[model samples]
Structure formats: structure tokens, C-alpha cells
Target: MADPKGFMTTPREEWPRRPVEERVRDWDEVYVPGALLPIISKQADRCMDCGIPFCHDVCPLGNLIPEWNDLVAREDWRAAADRLHATNNFPEFTGRLCPAPCEAGCVLAINQPAVTIKNVECAIADRAWEEGFTPPRPPDRLSGRTVAVIGSGPTGLAAAQQLTRAGHTVAVYERDDRVGGLLRYGIPSFKMEKRHLERRLEQMRAEGTRFRTSTRVGRDVAADELRTRYDAVVIATGATAWRELPVPGRELAGIHQAMEYLPLSNRVGEGDLVVSPLCAAGKHVVIVGGGDTGADCLGTAVRDGAASVTQLDIYAQPGADRDEDAEPWPTYPKIYRLSAAHEEARDLVTAPAADADARLFAASTLRFTGDGSGHVRSLHLVEVDAGRRPLPGTGRTLPADLVLLALGFSGPDRTDGLVDQLGLAMHARGTIARDAGFATNVPGVFAAGDAARGQSLIVWAIAEGRAVAAAVDRYLTGSSRLPAPISAYDRPMAV
Candidate 1:
């Protein structure tokens, strides 16, 4: 337990973001630097460490939230880092990227604001790196078995690290030029700089995990060849095939998928390009979708100096507070909250009260209007009721020189021909089919992460990676001691 009566006395305090005006000038992270360390211990003390710690139950990684919270309160960062890394291979990634479902399941959330679990987790991870407490744990001896992991995202990285430390030779292959998949390209530097990823990859390399970059498994190297050479293979390729909107004028020049635009910006951060082809500079940008991806686009566009920005949501805006009747205790509820990007966009409003939020809820896109050059000119939309039926006299047009589709993903990208090569079966939801043991029908072949679980949070990806690694170890050695955090069917309250 952190502090016996601290939950009642200490109010929840989170890491503060830099002022919107100041943060918009640069592509660095939005948080106010050095503001978290002083107050994080007090915030960690707010954890009740309840009899039934639902925080652990909801976390896909099954992280020891209470134990770490107590350690942080006592200023024992080394022990807290150990407890954190015991389950999560990459706490820094989750602390920055995850939506933190553990906080939603907090017992304190029933009455008071939940403990700042995510911020404390980030603090411990950052401190560990600073104090050199996080060192490469190389295996004492080799197991004489080989494993090939497809993809270098969180899942593949976790599995490779776990297996390597457990005395197995592991090699990770990535299609991109760099090792980190979405972590290297899909996310912007402002959200989390690539240095965090680079540091972790350095540790993995020291632990003897071989990485093969710019190598497509099905094309550059045959998948069948890898299966023949290695004793076992694990597929962790993420869900990259994006969902599309097939409305009229969908082929306009200025319209693109979020993945297309985001990766370009990330390349610019890597010094590969001076300006992204889909740059929103000096343009009126409109984004379709109201999830975290949309918010990411919003922030990127704002930093790029978009003349104006508006986000569209098909569903109605969530309530400011949790609706208990709709979602009772222990269930993650949908509530309105301002993300860093939302806060930045809120400062750029010039319209009337209706458009003050820079977001339009119950909004449906009728079609896009284009100029003579086949470039997007404006967006045609209509306000809708609860059922999404367009209301009478609610049609309007907004200037939009650029349009981005952040409408999420459908399934894994099969264009690589890997799935066809393996003859793997897919679930009804279009994800890879896996049994309770996280193994596919093909013997010695397994799948994990978004490739197996569909579009989800990094936390779930890491958890599935750890679990699948244990299954693979057991298959290789007949018996294993690795911890399996969750089964393939275990879904958490996260994207």
C-alpha cells in the first residue's frame, strides 16, 4: 500500500502539458519538461491498493500497479523499475501511448479521480534509464533452438527479448528500413521521440537479438525458407491495412489515409524529407474520425501551421462525466476529455459557439467537393440526430484544402503474400486464427500482436507478445517457466 489514507487526502495530479502556443512552435513532446518528477511521488501515494485491485485485472500486461505505486511513494525507484519490467517489456511505450484502461478500472474512480498510474509508470521507466538500472539481461547459456519473429513492433520486440533472455536464439525481421514498425514511423515525434525507441533497441541488441531491417519476409526472403531454417516462427506484423471511405470524389489529390500522411511526417523528423508531400501548411484541413489517430492528425496539422482545422465524429460527443447508468462501476466508460492536441486546437477557433470545440459530433460527410484540378476544395457535411439521420436544413460546407481519413484499420496487410504463403486461417473478424495456446494450425508456427488481435493498443500487443513467447518456449523445450500474461481471447478496455 502506498499511503493508508492518502486516497482521501491527495487529489489526482497529472503531468502538465506545455502551453499550447509554445508547444505548437516545435515538434517536441507537448509535456512541460521537468514538471512531473517533483509531484509524481505524491500522486503515486494516492493509490488505495484495494483488496481487489481491478487495475491489475484490466491491464493487458497485468502490471503490478499497486506494488510499483508503493515503491514510488517510498522513493525506491530501482525496485519499482524491477517490478515494472517483470511484466512489461517496454513501459515507456505504454506510459506514453496507451489510453491507460488500468486507471478506469481503479477502485478510487468510483468516487474520486483515479490515481495517476500512467504518469507514475512513465516516471519510473524514465528514472530507470537515467540511473542505469535497466541493463541487458543476456541468457547464461543457449537453448540451441532458433526462432524467427516477423515484424519489429512492440509485439515482436517483446517476444524476441523474452525468448533471448530465456536462452533461445531470436531474429526479428522488419519491412521498413528501421526496426520499430509503427513506433518508428506511424507515430509523430511530438507524441514520443524516436530516441526512446532507439535506446530500447540498443538494449535489445546487446541482449543478442538479431534484427534484419529493410527485409520483407514474403518477398525479399521467402517465408517458407525461414520456416525451414528456424525451429519456430512468430508473426507479429501489425494491422496496417487501413479502412477507406468510398464516398463520391474519394480520389481527390489532397485526400489521403492517415497512415500515408503520418509516416511522411515521421520521415521528415528523421531528416529524410524537407517537407511531407501531404503537408497541411497554409491549408484548411478537415479530419474524419474521432479516435486517437484523429487527434494525432490534429496535432500534426496544427504543428504544420494549417490555416484551420476541424474534426468530424459520426457518433455524438461523449458526456463530460461517466454515465453510471450506461456504464456501471469497473467498466471503462466513455467520457469527454481534452487531449494535448485538442487543447492545442481549442486555441485556434474563430467560428461561432457551434464550432467552438474544433470538433463536430453527430456529423456525417455527404461528399467532398473538388476544384477543376482534381484537388480537394471543400467538405460537404450534414448534422445528424442520434440515429445518424441527417437533420433538415443542417447541410453546410467547410473550406478544406486537405482531407485526412483516420477511420482506423480493418485487418492485417495481406498484400505482402505472407499469409498466403503460410496458408494460415483467419478468424471471423479477419484477424489471424490462433488456438488457446496462441499457436496457429500449422505446427511450430504462431502469431501475436495486432496481426492476431486486430487493431489494439501497444499494451495488448506487448502482453500478447509475452504470452506467445511462453507458448513458443514450451513448444520448443516441452516445458517452460516463462510467464503467460494473457490468452489470445483476452481483450482489454483499449483500442
Candidate 2:
């Protein structure tokens, strides 16, 4: 245990966000630089080191939480980093992007606040990089097997790193101009800078993971040819087919998909463009969705100097505290939360003190109205009850020059002809279907990540990647020693 009485003595604390006024002026990350390190040890000491740590089970990666917590509390940062990397290939990404289900499963959360596990993980990863503790570890000998992995997101990257370290020749192919899929473009720079991603890629390259960017399977290279060339193929293509807002005036000039708008802004950050073609400057922007994508749009719009930003959520506002009867302990619960982007939007001049909530919960978009010139002008909406039935006399309109649909994705896009050429079966929900071992219908072809599990968190993506790698290893050799964190059909604790 960390400090025998640490849980009772220390209070929970988190990384402080940069001031809204200062942060909104730049696209830098929202955190105050170097703020987490000083207090992270104390926060990590709060872990109880329970007899049965639910946090471990809740995490898809099955990270050694208590061990790392104890090491961090003892100021053994190098050992903490080793423990963190033992299960997770990219703690940096999960620390920045994951919603932290482990915290929800924390035993301490039964009464007091949970330990800052995510912050502690992020601190260790950053310190490891600063001290040059993160280095390439190439395989000792080649296994004489070749593997092809499509998509360079977290899943593909994790799998590639694992296979490379395990003595296999791995090649990751990405359709994008750069290696990273959403990590390079889907995510805005303000949330997580591109530099963090670049450094990791450098390490992967040194570890003998070949990256072939600007190459599209089933397009530039035939999918059948890839299968013939490699001993096995793993599909890590994420769920990118976005859901549509089927409403009137759908062809309005200013209305764009969240992926389309976000990528262009991210391109500007990558220095590929001086300005985004879908710039939100001086426009009234309306985002349809209350999830992280919408929050991302909110932050991007604010940085682009939008005149006003409004986010609409179809579901009712969640309560501040967990509903014990509805959602018991050891499960993730729906609770009202504020992101860094929401805080910046709250400080907007357009958001009044009385009703500063940028998110309008239980509000449904009826339709969009466009100007005579075909540009979006206003959005029609109405309040709805729990059943999603529109309430009477609740219809209203808000000015909207640019509208972004952050309604989330459907499944892996088959337009590339990869699924058609490979004859892979898809689940009823539209994701690629796989057996318990993460194998597709076709032999020697496997699926993992969002392509197989539907849109999910980065933690699950990494877990699926690691598990699928183990399965592929076993398929090649009679037996395998690689760790499989979770099965393909495994689900997270119900919320």
C-alpha cells in the first residue's frame, strides 16, 4: 500500500485547466504546463490497494493500477512507467483521450472521490519521455512470418508494436497522407498536440514497424493481393461511416459533417493549409450532438472565432450524482460533466450568466432553414420528453450560419471495396463480425478495434489490438505466450 493511511488523509485533486480567456486565444492544450507532476504523487497515494481492485477489471488494458499507484506514491517513477507499459502500449493516448472507466470502478468511489489514476498515468508517460526512458525494443530474432495491418489508429499502432517486439515482420498501411488515422486529423490540436503522436511514431519506426502512408487497400493496392503477399491480415479500420441528420434543407452550403469540418481545421494546425475551407470565423455555429465530438467541435469553433456556438442534445440532462438504484457501484454511470471546451464556451460573450450552458439538453433538431443563396441561416428545434416525444409549444429557432453534425459514426465504411473484395461478414449493427478469437469469416483474415466492436473508446481499441495480436500469433505458431487482455465479445461494465 502507498501510505497505509493515505486514502483517509489525502483529498482528491485533478489537473487544473488553463484560464479560458488565455486558452481561447491559442490552440495549445488546455492544461497548465507542469501542473500535474507536483500533486500527482499525493493523488496516487489515495488508492486503497483493495483486496480485489475493480479498477483493473474495468480497464480494457487491465493496467496494473495498484502496483503503479504504489510506485508513484513512493516516487519510483521509472518503475511506475514500466508497470504502466507492461499492459498498455500507449498510455499517453489513453491518458489524454480515454474517459477513465477505471476511476468509476475504483473502490474509493463508494464514498469519497476516486484517485486520479488517469493523471498519474499521463504524468508517468510524460516523465518517461522527458528522461529518455522510452526507447525502441526490437525483436531478438525474426519469426519468418509477415503480417499486414490496415489503419494506423491506436489499434493498428498497438498491434504493430506488439508484433514487432514479438519477432514478426509487421507492415501498417494507412490511406491517409500521414500515418495516424483520427489521431492525426480527427482530433483537434488543442485537445492533444500532434507532437505527442509524432514522437511515438519515431519510436515505432526504430522498432522495425514499417509504415506505408498514402496507400489505400482495395484502391491503390488490391485487397486480394495484400492477403496473398502477407501470411495474415488484420483489419483495424475504425467506424468512420458517420450518421446523418435526415432533415429538410440537407443540402445547405454551410452544413458539414463533423469529420469533414474537424479534419480541415486540423489540417490548418498541421501547416498543410493557411486556413480551413470550413472556417467558423464570425459565424453562428450549431453542433448537433452532446458527446466528445460535439465538445471537440465547440472548442474548434471557439478557437476559430465563431460568433456564437450552441450544442443540442437529444437526451435529457444527466444528474450531477450517480443514481444508486438505477446504476449500482462498480459500473460506469451517466453524470453531468463539464469538459474544457464546455468551460470555454460558457465564458463566451454570447453565453449569458443566467443560462450559460452551451449544451441544450433534451432539445431535438426539427429542420434547417437556408437563405435564398443556399447558405444555412437558422435551425428549427423543439424540446422533447424522456420518450423523445416532442412537447407542445416548445418549438423554437436559433440563428445558425454553419452547422456541424457530430452525431457519431455508424460503422466501418465499406465503400473502399475492402469488405466486398474480402467477403467479410458484418454484424447487424453494421460493424464487421468476428468470432471469439477476433477472426473474420475468411481464414487468415482477422478484425479488431472499432471495425469489429463498433465505435468505442481508445482503451478498448488498444485492448482489442493486443488480443487480436495474440490470436494471430497463436494461429501462426502452435502455441503463444502473448497476453490477451479481453475476448472479442467482452463488454465493459454496464453504465
Candidate 3:
């Protein structure tokens, strides 16, 4: 380790976030400006570099936290980036987007705040790109085989990069106008800017991954035609099916899905023209669901000058620390955490900020009441127990000009022309079912990421991508040397 007594001597300190008041004015990334420089080497030096790291076990990617932390502490940032890239193809993306299960799994976190593993990893990646440490690792010899990846999300990108580097011609297909899938659209720029994704895409391009956006397989091109053209096909199409609430007034104007609202704001940030736009401006916005997606909506609406915002969660508020039965050490904790959005909302509702109403936990929506004009104007809500059954005498009416269902996704868009025309089988839960090698029942076709696993972490998506690439390579060549970071049959390993 860089500092022998670093863990004992230094307390953890992290990069500071930009002041909320200043950041909400614009759509620029909320953290990057002031977040990168404070590498907090002393904090990195806190890593024990344990003989058997639970952090790795907890992380879906199994990132070498201690190795990179030590490298960062020693000021060997290039080597740190190398170690980081060994497991994660796009640390820039994961560094920004992932919730850092590794930190939660840290042995040190049993007491202290744990090593700043995620921050160190992101810092190393940023520094590497700045110092010209990252370069394309083009294959020396070409394999005559070709592979097609159907989806340009993290999974597709990683699979394409790995396959392209392994000397196979690879093409990534995205249905959206641009590549990067959800990264390009679903995710808001406030948490992570588009530049991180763009830079990584540039690297993948240099390494010879051909990208074909605005193209949907089984629509633009027949599924069978793609199979005949490519040596192998990997489906990384993520779960895009939004879980809808079936309450009354569901189809009314001013009621929108979370994806619909989030993407429009993101697109607006991208300088795109608003066509029949969904704006939260000067409206009383009520978001139903208490997950990160809901928090994201809260932030976006606040920035858009929503007259008021209220978030509702069906479950009771979680504890500030781990609950024994729910989350144990080395597993991610189930606890009440205040996100930046929650903080901003608190600032609005409780303090000086102009507008914020409430975040009602254990609250369930009974129904939406609409004016005769067919626009949503209010909602009937009730308090509920842990089982989400309504409590007696808890019903009340709340003003709601706009209701966003942030309840989360059910699975991929199975009804889309692509899945329907191809006749892909979905699991009972609506996710595509794949075997140990990520192969679907359909021969020569494979699935991975959220499309197969349902809504999941970015780390899992990338791991699934790398694993699927290995499977595809082996299928085409009858053997493979690619790193299989995960297999469909593999679960999180425990000691």
C-alpha cells in the first residue's frame, strides 16, 4: 500500500458536489466540475487491500478496488487505470453511474465510511484519459468471423469492444437516433454528462467497433437476415418496458411515464427542439414511486420550475443503517439514503427554496381525479402498511397537475415490432430467458443485460456483455480466449 498507516491515520473525505443553487440553473453535469480533482489519496490509502476482498465479491464487475486504490495512492494513475480497465471496459460510465456496491461491501465499512473506491476509480479513469494513458488495443491478427450486437447500451458497447479487440468484425445496432442506448437518453445529464459516454465511444470506435444507430433489427433488417450475415449475434437490448400504474385517469393529458418525461428533459439539454414536449414547469408534479428514478424526476422538475413536487413511496421509510434481516454486510445495505434530489427537495420544501411539498412514505395512490377538461388536476392518496394495504381513515385528496409513474420497469419492450416479429420468448416476468451461455431457445441468438436479467446495475450489464462476447466467440470458433467475467449461471460468489 502507498501509505502503510494510511487507514489508521487518515479520515475519509470525498470530492465536493457543486452547490445545488448554482447547478439547478443549467443542464450541465452536477458533479464533474468540482468533483474530479479531489482524488483524496489519503482516503484511497484507507484500503486494507484485504487478502480476500468482499468489495470485489459485492461488485457485479468484481472490480479490483484495492489494486487501483493502491495505485492511485501511489500516484501511479496510469497503472491504476490499467487495473481498472482490466475488469471494466468503461470505468468512465460505471464510475459515474454505478451505485458502488464495492464500497458497501468494503470490510472497512463495517465501521468507517469505507475506502473511497468509486471516487478513486473515476479519478484514475479521468486522469488516464487526460494523460494519454488510454489507447486503442486493436488486434494484431484478424479472425474471419463477424459478430452483430443488437443494442448500444453498456452491455452492447462492452461486448462490441471485447469482440472487436479479439479480431472479429463487430457492429452495434441501436434503435434510438443515437447510440449509447439509455446512457444517451434515459439517464439525466445532471448526474453524469454525455461527454464521458462520448469519449468512451470514441475509444471503442478507434479500436474498430462499427456503430449503426437509428436501426432496429427485425424492423430495419430481418432477424434471420442478420443471423445469416453475421457469424454470431448477441442481443443486449435492455428492458425498456416501463411498469405502469393501472389507476383511473391513467390515459389523461399531463400524465406521463417516467421515461417519457426524463428523456424529453435530457433531449432539451442536448439542444433538440421540443415537439409536443412534456414540461413540469409551473405545474404541481406528483411522482409515484420512491426509487432512484423517482428522485431523478424530482430533480428534473425542480430545475424546470415546477410549482410544487411531491414523491410517494409505497414502502415505509428505511433505516439510516442496515437492517439485519434485509441487508447484511458485504451485501448492499437497505437503508434510507438522501439522494441529491431529495436534498434539493428538502431545500425547497423545508427551507428557503421556493417550492417543495412532501415525500410521503408508505403512501399509495387510490385514484386520480380529473377535471371535466380531461386533464389530471388531483389525486386520492392513502397511507399504507408494510404490505401496502390501505390504512383505515388515511385517504386524502392532493392537488396534482402532473402525475409521473416512476414505479420502475417491468422488462424489455416485448410488444415492439422487433420482439414481436422475431418471436422471442419472454420469461413469466417479461424478461428474455437465456441459458448459461446467454443463448436463447432460438439457435445462434443470445441475450444479456437488462433484456434478460430485468432492470439491473450498469456493472451487471457490462459483465453480462463481456460474458456474452466470450460465448459468441466460442460458438463461432469452437473455442475462445476472451475473459468471461460472468456466466449466466453464475451468482455472486461468497467466501
Predicted candidate 1 versus true structure: per-residue lDDT over 281-313, tens digit per residue:
989999998899988999999999998889998
Q: List the residue pairs that clash in candidate 2.
A: none
Root-mean-square deviation (CA) per prediction = 1.6, 1.2, 2.3
Best model number under TM-score? 2
- Point out where model 1 deviates above 4 Å: 350-356, 493-495
Off by over 4 Å in 3: 32-35, 274-276, 350-358, 491-495
TM-score of each: 0.97, 0.98, 0.95
Looking at candidate 2, the ten consecutive residues that score lowest on lDDT are 348-357
Candidates sorted on TM-score, descending = 2, 1, 3
Candidate 2 deviant stretches above 4 angstroms: 349-356
Which model is ahead, 1 or 2, in terms of TM-score? 2
Q: How many backbone clashes can be found in candidate 2?
A: 0
- The TM-score measured for candidate 1 stands at 0.97
lDDT of 3 by residue, 1-495 (tens): 788788888888876777878887877766747455565677788999888899988887778888988888888888888999999999888877888888889988888788888778778888889999898888898899889899999999999998999899999988888888889888888888898888989988888889998887877888888888987888888988898889887877888889899888888877785532778888889899888888889988988888888888888877778765667787787677777777777866721222233578888988897889999999788999988799999887778899899888878885546666556788899888888889988788889999898888888999999989889989888898988888786765333
